[model samples]
Target: MSNPIMMYTEGLHTIPLEREGIRYFVSSNSENCKNGLKLHVEVQPKDSPSRALPNTQNVVAAEPTSPSGSAHYGHSVILSILLCVIVVLAY
Candidate 1:
């Protein structure tokens, strides 16, 4: 078996099921796993491949309206500090 890719970063869980004599492990995210056990395998509509859902908590939201003209001032200060650091390193 190859290295299993982690589906969930937290609350990792699995449910074992036998479909057509094939044992399979499904994630806790599935409806069957989410809500109690499903007695039989039901045909599901063809679904688009799943994509990783990003965590909103980790997403950095854009600064809600940077204080008017503060951007230029912030940039100038950062640049000045960077230049000073470079000069000090050079010496």
Candidate 2:
């Protein structure tokens, strides 16, 4: 309600949390963490989504893929197919 708490030591990000209690550290470099944003995501009474995660074991995160240096897929697939056809015909 007052201000968002610092969770991660790096990056400018905001996360909302509410619990029975929590603990945190205050330091000079970590001061910017205090300025992170806050959002309230509370479960409503008789909510269903809370049943999904208990031990949090049922969730798996898909890692973000780094972009390949070239536009590897969009054009190369067509070009390779055409080249293969040309090679077969020339033979």
Candidate 3:
């Protein structure tokens, strides 16, 4: 399968992803993502609308919580994989 095209922009961005039999998208803003070290992940069904309507209740802020040791490790691994993906795709 071909990978999706991703454009690197200055503000909030959303990327669609599918795993196993599940479909979702992840949205993140570099400026608001802990200096690009973290992501503001949002998941929705494939049938749902990708863009949130203004003043709609579809958008919900994620609850803030401290990451455990394992969570930190997972985040690091994810970051590494993301970096590798970017490098490979850029070529």
Off by over 4 Å in 3: 1-69
| Model 1 lDDT tens row, 3-82 | 44434447645554433343334444566666664333554444455754555367678878656787659988999999
lDDT at residue 10 of model 2 (Cα atoms): 68
lDDT of all the models against the reference?
Answer: 0.57, 0.57, 0.57
Worst 10 residues of 3 by lDDT: 19-28
Model 1 weakest 10-residue run by lDDT: 16-25
Put down candidate 3 lDDT per residue, 47-73, tens digits, no spaces: 546564566566788999876779758
What's the lDDT of the predicted structure labeled candidate 1?
Answer: 0.57
Error of 1 at 68 (Å): 5.0
TM-scores of all models? 0.25, 0.24, 0.23
> What order do you get sorting by TM-score, best first?
1, 2, 3
The residue pairs in collision within model 2 are: none
